[model samples]
Target: MYQFDKRIVMTLDAGGTNFVFSAIRSNEEIVEPITLPSNGNNLEKCLETMVTGFTAIKLKLPEAPVAISFAFPGPADYVNGIIGDLKNLPAFQGGVALGAFLRKHFGIPVFINNDGDLFAYGEALAGALPEVNRMLQEAGKNKVYKNLVGITLGTGFGGGVVRDGELFLGDNGAAAEVWVLRDKRQPVYGVEEGISIRAIKREYAQLSGDLRMLSPKDIFEIAEGKQAGNMVAARETFNHAGEVLGEAIASINAVVDGIVVIGGGIIAAYKYLIPAVMRELNGTLEMYEGTSVDRMEMKAFFLDDVADRDAFLVSTSRRIMVPGTTETIEYDSVKKMGVIMTRLGTSKAIAFGAYAFALNELDKC
Candidate 1:
């Protein structure tokens, strides 16, 4: 939203094998990215690579960067920028003060955070949240939203919460770890077991007597009757993921009470997943007395559904008179939430998140 801000932030896209570094100004990349090997098994080389990458970007800029910010794999002390044991980057298994090293080297403020958190923050700052509000305004509605929950469904299930334009990083730096929740379909496994790439393949394979694994893309195509695979089995696989994802999101919504935006590769098949998600959200829970209660207090609407999007944008407020006075005030009592796929690509969202976060924090100082 603050695309006119003049401050520059150095950012990187850290991956398992490489570090792609660049500088962001006005919420956009200002230069071509510089790449370097991550050398994840060797701490010394990995650290050096990060420094080199940032330094190269720094030299190309005519202006000094005000801060350094980027996302890394988590299980980290993000507040202090210390990385914990990472399965992909084994050299950090013993913990490393990555943020501190960068600050000392560059003599600028350094901020590090989980990718999920940054992704949510980015969307909250510039993507889905604002777009929805703009829609409401254009529709001449008074309803406005101030919170969002963003999730990524790719290699694993991941999420972040943003409220009132602030990313919610909970105590112990482990907030929004949705993947660890118990799977409803498999009590012995985490929810991630039923919501990831592998989940689609595993479920599709198990559905057929031949028991062959297939990529999620190919399976989705099969479900569209465009490829040579079991169509029913492929559709069921996505439904399975949707059921578990819905459970996790509904539980999260109880606390967040906001809009939900989903990203990652799997969301491309939202058509198949969202119906199952809606079923679980609108489903009921049983009481000891055999009464069925709505699954969530706030009804979750899939925004891709044209009718649902219209409902979400409609104003539910009206003027009400006080019981014992002549005074009246406008009030709204609708409790609802909307979920949709991310319009902004995940990587761009993360980069914008880093850029916005750094500028915000710098302003505080």
Candidate 2:
């Protein structure tokens, strides 16, 4: 396909372990994306590297993208355009003036958001939340839905909340830190520490006292086969996870009633474990006949190139783009890190995409 008047938007997901960048032309079509190992040990040095890389990517733009949206693996004062003390990302602890720095250099608007928050917002705008919402709407008058909770289990767990169609970050945009599950039973450890994939492995091994080593994948396989020792161990460990997860969700439900959507590699291993999770959640609910325990609805998202998944591209195009506007086409099949975001340092592109989205929405207001 050939085109004229093309507009490019770049998005970045700078994570602790991996950084991915993607360039989207009108949502579906990708011009390029790149991925790289991240070394966020030093803030100024990493930002410097990012700037250098972005310069190179600009040379290949299909006519400089309209905006950029960046997702950083840290705490950010999104309203003020400052990165706060991100515990996992030591380099950005004190805070980075990402917005001013980008604007002075590129003369383009940029937007920043917490990766988990953006992930959930984008999912609702474009991915799994829609499916879950549809199911709730079907549940009819009994439905008490008001928000969207996204739980992602990757290197660690990522929690995000969406209320009334917008990312609800509370005063500081940190409302979705649901991984900090306080288990009185465990006393010392939080939920992430006790039930994350890493924790599950340690608990399983310690209880079994098996000298033989096993990967998390192996644990799931053993659980699937219902093997005697492994099943007993797996059931015990995962049931604890479900209980912790249920508690977290129940607490959130008290504040903002909504469906919980759980994703991530670990959950993929044992899809059947949700039943145990739902059972545990039932114990937490104090229903008086009318309300009863129901399975928490879950959905999986594209694990790769998540930065450019265009959660709102389809909806935006349909609502805003002109009819017969073949000049711009959207495709969601390609799965690769954007060139600028991953290798050439395209954090600006990400910030730009997000800014564009925010501006567009603001205009509708």
Instruction: Choose the strongest candidate by lDDT.
Output: 1
Can you tell me which runs of candidate 2 are displaced by over 4 Å?
1-7, 85-88, 133-146, 211-215, 225-229, 284-365
Predictions in order: lDDT? 0.88, 0.56
| Candidate 2 structure quality by residue, lDDT tens digits, 35-132 | 65556777777676556545555666768765556676555777556887866667877778886786667766666776556555555444554554
Give the per-residue lDDT of model 1 (tens digit) for 188-303. Answer: 99988998998888888888643655788988998999998888888988998899988888888888899999988898788999998889888899999989999888877778
Clashes of each: 0, 28
Q: RMSDs, each prediction?
A: 1.7, 12.4
Candidate 1: the clashing residue pairs are: none
TM-score of each: 0.95, 0.69
Native-to-model Cα distance after best TM-score fit, residue 165 in candidate 2, in Å: 1.6
